[model samples]
Target: MNQSVFQKAMNEIHSRRLHASAENERRFQEINTVIPELAEINFQMAQTASRILHGEKIDKIRQQNLQAQRYARQLLVTHGYPEDYLDMHYTCPYCQDTGYFQGRYCTCLEKEIASLSVETLNRNTQLQLRSFDQFSLEYYRGLTKSNTKGETVDCYAKMKKTLDYCIQYARNFTAHAPSLLLYGEVGVGKTHLSLSIVTEVLRQGYEVIYDSVGNLTSQIEQEHFNREKSDINTLKLLLDAELLVMDDLGTEFQTSFTDSVIYNLINTRLNRNLPTIISTNLTPGKLEEQYDERIMSRLCAVYQVWELMGEDIRMLKMKERRSSQYL
Candidate 1:
């Protein structure tokens, strides 16, 4: 989250690209070489500037950049011309290689790539469990069980506001942001909002993780029952991430061990001041009934619970689309 990590990443990127990694460096240097055209251009600029140094040209040394531009165009042509290219090309597109865009983080995008770098989400080597951009709000309908006039205006407003709030929170997250619990029915956008936060926080340079409750509990169970120590490493990852998000909490296969683990996780995080986000279809009262009041009450002290209400937005959208087709 601080600046040193970014500096290290930059150094690593350069080291991986230059000098000892000559073949890799060659790829970029090929674009930046002081070729014959570039050398001629530089020689002309220096010759004219020497006159200026002696007070001869007087506000009339043809701009060095202008000379470079002609050479750049010729270089593009020799390589096979493309009309309307960059007036000037960027060598390192990030930071313009100046290292910062404006006053904020120059390697701004480094944050975005970090969250996905985690083993479960690593886009480089495998398919993601889900993707943030693929989330659709069309799954939520504004209706609760009481009545359905398609969807309630109140529910839509609240969910939309919630989405906006979650986005803002992710953009502005700091070390002390409170933990969150997104409680709702199936397809209510809880997972979407949670994934969105993970995506944004990673972009902002914090390590975050998202996992299903069932997968988490199963891993914990295996780690506990097995004699070998290495498999328990999965739980270690969960406990170690900067922000850990557990999705579909109540739906996980519940055993006495799982119940104890869940309580321990919530309580341990609260004690350590580590942050966690949990999503479940269970209500607060239902959670108490399912896991016992003591564990539920302790969670209430440290987490903000958001109750999501509405029909599945996905189902509503699908029906709406089919109705439109019939019409």
Candidate 2:
């Protein structure tokens, strides 16, 4: 498991602890107002508990404490509140939101850590910035025509349609959602929309794995040639993620090993009916030339193909920056 996953779980436990404390205090304040003597009883109970350290028997103090608790419950019942309403409320009562019980990590914490581990193992934090709301279709402005290849050429209308498709895909994503192939030229929002989809999918609580093709291939190559067999293989993570988003698909240093690994990952995911999002700067013809027929067949046939059409937004941003500098 990733160390950051465990850290995230610990942070969640801290938040739950604070929430429980605040809830307890809020309830105490509400009840204390109705029964002023309840505060005195609580103080006396604390003092009585301290007597245990002095070797005093708790029989009498126990009876007094029981009576106070009964009185508190009765008062709560009279005021239309639950009997345990004033007690410390916990989101996870099993561990009291402490993430541990009986000197070990609790089930809830373990589950959270495991979920986060799967996500972190597959995720690229650098891609976290892009989102649906942040994308600007205005950059795609031009004609609405399609080229001779029957592909939508550079146009605002075509890009807007692609944007709508991605937004819908993200909004409706599930564990069993269809796989996606986002193909376009460089700086045409293929990566942007793919990242945005993953972000929305993550927000919906599904564990997603995201990585650029270059990074993914390099990591797999390193692991494949490692002398130590004990090292964890990232290929498993890539194949098993609930939603795998592979960005910059044709940018990796292609080789026999990388080609095989890419095929295995995509083919395996497809066989298992797992969803994957592939963003590439290559057309179907170019992709065929780069990869074999098997990989391209799986991607083109099985995945929901989305071809993005627009001007190079990166160049536009660069020119805008230059203009601003002149100003």
Candidate 3:
């Protein structure tokens, strides 16, 4: 919990409180102008406290206040308005948008803090550039591959199914959605599809982090060693995000620190039953070799593994550009 992130969340809560108050005042004024009797009732209701201070019997004043409130509500309903239309409507009724209740921080405030933290962490990534619509299956057209079951599969058909699956996965994503292991050779759209899922999941208002494993590991290493001046608890954020997407899994600089960090992150998230999406160029065997049995066992047991197949779409696009330039 960084101080700046907490302050930002508090500021948002203050803004919501102010908006609710302003809107309530506006509604009261409008009703006062439209119905003069409501103004009189409101005046009487406002005088209850002063009347009690001036030696009026507390029960009598309280009764008068309740009667005034009932009359006001009746007036509102008779005039085609809800009884609570003039009440201050808060975005969160629990805290009245003040961000605290019962001497503790409200759940709404905690959620805001979490959302803001994810936003801060993802500020550097280009999450907007990738989408499912931009992913094409044309690159796999007329290609064929043999599956593990010793059956010939049409690459285009297989990839089309993969594309559809990714789209539906994004569209119907939830916090409890199954974790994913997207493994394939370079430029087979592993990054693209994973990013596509990330964009949609984010739009659906889940906290998602998308970054390369190498970059994230570097940041974690820096924060862990106090080599960088950052207040954010990077490892905690990664573990707690609603959906964590780590790309290029095996490309990070290997060290004891990175290995421990990666293993802890995976194990913690799995224990918490949170969803994570990992894209890697390494096959299952290579991944086991790169990490160890502990990491591979968890991934194989829980993750929905998808093996993307195709030639390098980047190379195909480059050739297309060159041919167009010649023409």
Q: Which candidate tops TM-score?
A: 3
Q: What is the lDDT of residue 61 in candidate 1?
A: 57
Q: Tell me the tens digit of each residue's lDDT in model 3 across 213-251.
A: 898999888777785466477788899999999999999
Q: Compute the lDDT of residue 305 as modeled in candidate 2.
A: 83
Candidate 1 lDDT score at position 10: 60
Task: Order candidates by lDDT, high to low.
Answer: 3, 2, 1
Q: Predict model 2's lDDT versus the native.
A: 0.80
lDDT values for all models: 0.66, 0.80, 0.87
Per-model TM values vs. the true structure: 0.58, 0.65, 0.88
> How many residue pairs clash in each candidate at the backbone level?
9, 0, 0
Q: What is the lDDT of residue 5 in candidate 3?
A: 91
**lDDT, model 1, position 288:** 76
lDDT of 1 by residue, 1-327 (tens): 224444555664454335334653453355446355544554565576567778865544556556566776777677664522433334455554344566755553353224323543333223233444565555544444422123435666666667767877787787667889888778777877787788778777777666788877887788778875431245655665688888898898999898888888887777777889999988776787888676788778778877776777778778889999998
Better of 1 and 3 by TM-score: 3
**Candidate 2 TM-score, C-alpha based:** 0.65
Which residue pairs overlap in candidate 1's backbone? 111-202, 111-203, 112-203, 138-313, 139-312, 139-313, 139-314, 140-313, 142-152
